[model samples]
Structures are given as structure tokens and as C-alpha cells.
Target: MKTMRIWFGCSMGLAVSMIFGWSYGFFAALLPMFVLVQADRWSTPLHVQLVLEIVWVTVQVSLLVGFFQPYPLLMTTAVAIMMLFKCVAMQHKSTYLFGFTGLLIGSILLNFASYNFFDIEEFSINLWMCGLATAPITALAYFLFPEPECATPQPVTVNNEVTKDEYGMVRQAAMGWTVAMIAYLVFNLVI
Candidate 1:
């Protein structure tokens, strides 16, 4: 059942993307897959997923117009700081969301640079539209196939010197930083 839901959502997203065009469809398909997987693990609400998508689109636009071109160094520094902050603040819960956002922003910036900077406005609009399109598809998937409840939350056990939870936190932070750096590097290389 779970696997079916994943396939259904991914196929729908991919179909929608193909209708829009190749470039847009790729992300349209990809974002829903990411969201569905996260939703399954965390049991994140549809509203929260939608909110995150909005935030992702907003951050992408802001980075492209306000900071990416004019102050590339400043933009990269700010993204690194923000990613680190989210890592520390949200810990395990935010790992996927923050990391994915960083990658998305980086890719968007890279695309803009590779094409024409003047198209930033249009690109931002298309991204927002993609997010809007993805939201409903993901929401429907979650609605159709809900997550199973755990009887009780499991406590993290100690491993080596650190608790499993602490180890996870560190891993999340490292992942966040790595994504941020890769995105930054991509942006820098393009522009």
C-alpha cells in the first residue's frame, strides 16, 4: 500500500511536470517524491509541507534577486549561517527540509546564472507555480495513504560516548553544512 502510494504520487508529479515542460517537470516530479518520503517518516501535516514549499520558493527568489548576484559572498555566508541555525535549532526533524531547501536554492541560482540573470523574475514565478502544483499532489497522496502510528516513542540509546539522538543531531548538522557548501559552490561557479 505504501509503495503504491509512492508510485502514484511520483507518477502524477512526473506527468504534471511533463505537461509543463522538461525543466519544470523534473522538479515537479522530484519535490513531491522528497515531500512524500519525509511525510511518511515524520508524519508531517499537509499544511506544514505547503508552508515549507512556500518558504522554499520565497527564499529562492530572495537569494536570486537580493543577494546572489550583487553580493555572492554575502549570500553564500548568509545561507551557510541559516542552514547551520536550522540544523542546530530543529535537530533531526529539520535535516531533510533544510538540506533540500539549500540544494534547491543553489540549483535555482545556478540555472539562473547559466541562462540569463534577467530571467530571474520569470524563473521565480515558475518555481512558485511548481510548488503550488506539487502541494496538491502530495497532499492527496498523504490523504489517501496515511502514516501508521507508533505505539510509543522510542528513547535513544547510548552509543560510544554519545546518545543516539546526539549522534543524529551531529549527522544532521554535517549533512546541512555539506549541502549548503555544495550549493554555495555551485552558485559561485555559475556566477
Candidate 2:
């Protein structure tokens, strides 16, 4: 059942993207599919997902306009600040805040490197459309296929100290930053 939901969500995303246009269909599909999967795993609320998507778009635009064009130093500083915020947010167990934002940043950086930073309007349109499409699909999937009951409730632990999970989040942030840095360097070198 879970697998089916995942498949359906991905398919819906792809279909919507294809309807929008073939050139960016795959990339458009990826964001929705990723959000759907993560929402399932984390049990994130719809409102939260919506907010995250908005933030993701805002960040993408900021990077493209404010930093990616004429200010390398500002871009570097912005990336660093974002990475630090992601790490801290994760350590505080704010997964939803960091998860989508981190992914958005990394994806944008990597894609920018590969495709150059032209066509910002097209990219933004695709991303916003995909994000809007995700909401309905995600809501439908959750409503139609609710999570199954578990046999036993897992024990919950509260610890002030950093745990393995927190460490993993930090590592993820670091890796994302590293990838962004490499992408920026390659982009500069190539262009």
C-alpha cells in the first residue's frame, strides 16, 4: 500500500510536469515527488509543506537574482548562512524547515552548474507549477491511503545532547554545502 502511494505520487507529479512542458518535465516532477515522499516519511502537515514550498521558491529566486548574477562573495556568504541555518534547524529537530530548503538549495546549485543560470523565468515557472501540483496530489494520496496501524508504539526518548540523527543532519548540511561550492567553482570555470 505504501509503495503504491509512492508510485502514484511520483506518476502524478510526472504527468503534471509533462502537461506543463517536456523540456523541464523531469526536473519539475522531481520536486513534487521528493516532497511527497518526505511528507509521508515525516508525517508532515499540509500547511507545513505549503510553507516550505513557498520558502523554497523564495530562496531559489533570491539565489538567482541577488547572488548568482553579479556578486560571488555575496553568494558564498548566502550559501554559508543557509548551510548553518539548516544544520542548526536540524539539530533542533525542525526537519521540515531544513529538509526541503536544503534540497532546494542543493538542487538549484547543481542544476545551475550544469545548465548555467539563464532562463530564470522558465525555471521559476516550472518550479512553482510543480509545487502547486504537489499539494493536491499529496492531499489526495494521504486522504485516500492513510498509514496502517502499527502493532506496537515505539518508545520515545528525549535527550538534550546531540544524537546520531543530529550528527547525520549536520553531515548532510556539510555535504550539501560542499556540493554547492564545487558546483559554483565548476560554473565559474566553465563560464
Candidate 3:
């Protein structure tokens, strides 16, 4: 049931994005949707999350391959950002208010930052449109799925060490953002 909802959200989002010339939006929207469905839970298993991310990214790349310049970095980086926003949205619950706030604030800040850093055009409709749908999709998925489980981990201290989980959610999230950013910078530099 939960899995079905996630797929439904992704399918809906992908359909919308394709119509609007933002195929990446589908993947971006999924982050929040997935998180929203699992929000009540403390954490999801890393492997399961990774599989979803890979599948989403693959679909996104395949869909947009015909139109956009074949820039793996750009596509992957965008996916990373979508995933991050989804994580944040999930942590905050699937409230439309939060989603709206993130869309507005994030869009403004991201556009402004791009203008300053990349010196690119301001307020890209495609980018902002993606942001607009990101939160709603997440909320919708959350509403559709049953409340997530509240898993409790063992007590931890400075003395306790942690092991890497699959999907390397934390690590990949960080690496994705970093690599994407670096790739963007390099692209800008070369172009």
C-alpha cells in the first residue's frame, strides 16, 4: 500500500513534469513524497532508499535525454537537490504550508544565488516550477500512505561508533550535493 502510493506520486509528478518541460521535476518531487510517507518513522533502511533514488535518477535521465544537452553532472546534481528538499520536507511533515514556504523561499534564494554565483538568468520558470510541485507531491504521498513507524535506535555516545548503511543516504546526500555543485562550477567555468 505504501509502496503503491509512492509510485503513484512519482508517476503523477513525472507526467506533470514531462508536460511542463521539466522531466527532472518528477524525481525532485519524489524526494518529498517518499519522505512524507515515511515521516512518522525515524529512519528508512538505507538500501531501500538508494534503490529508489537510482531508479528515479535513471528515469529522469532517460526522459530528458532527447532535449537537454547530455550533461550527466547537471542531471545528477538536480536529482541531489530534489532529494535534499524531499528530506527536509519529510522531516517537517507534509504540511502544504511548509511546502509552499520552501517553494517560495527556496526558489527565491536559489535563483538569487544562481544570479550571483553563476551570473545566470534570474527566476527560471522551469526551476521554480519544479520547486512548486515538489512539496505538494510529497504531502500528497504522505497523506496517501499510513503513518510511518517510530523506530528507536540504541543509545549512542561519543564512545560509540557508527557503521555505514547501504544507499549511504547521508554520505550520498552530501556527496551528491558536493559533486553536483562542483560540476556546475566546472561547467560554468568551461563554458
Clashes of each: 1, 0, 2
A best-first ranking of the candidates according to their lDDT comes to 1, 2, 3
- Candidate 1, which segments miss by more than 4 Å at Cα? 20-23, 40-44, 60-64, 86-90, 94-99, 110-118, 139-168
TM-score of each prediction: 0.65, 0.68, 0.36
| Candidate 3 lDDT score at position 133 | 63
Model 1, 98-127: lDDT tens digits are 545545554555445544535655555656
Lowest-scoring 10 consecutive residues by lDDT in candidate 3?
Answer: 114-123
Q: Given candidate 1, what's the lDDT at residue 167?
A: 74
- Which candidate number would show the highest TM-score if scored against the true structure? 2
- What is the TM-score ranking, best to worst? 2, 1, 3
The lDDT values for all models are: 0.62, 0.59, 0.47
Better of 1 and 2 by TM-score: 2
Superior by TM-score: candidate 1 or candidate 3: 1
- Candidate 1: C-alpha lDDT: 0.62
lDDT of 3 by residue, 1-191 (tens): 56766676677678777777663454455544545454443233422343343434334433433333356566546634654564344233233233333333333333333333442122234444554565566556556765555598656668664654645655654664465455545544554
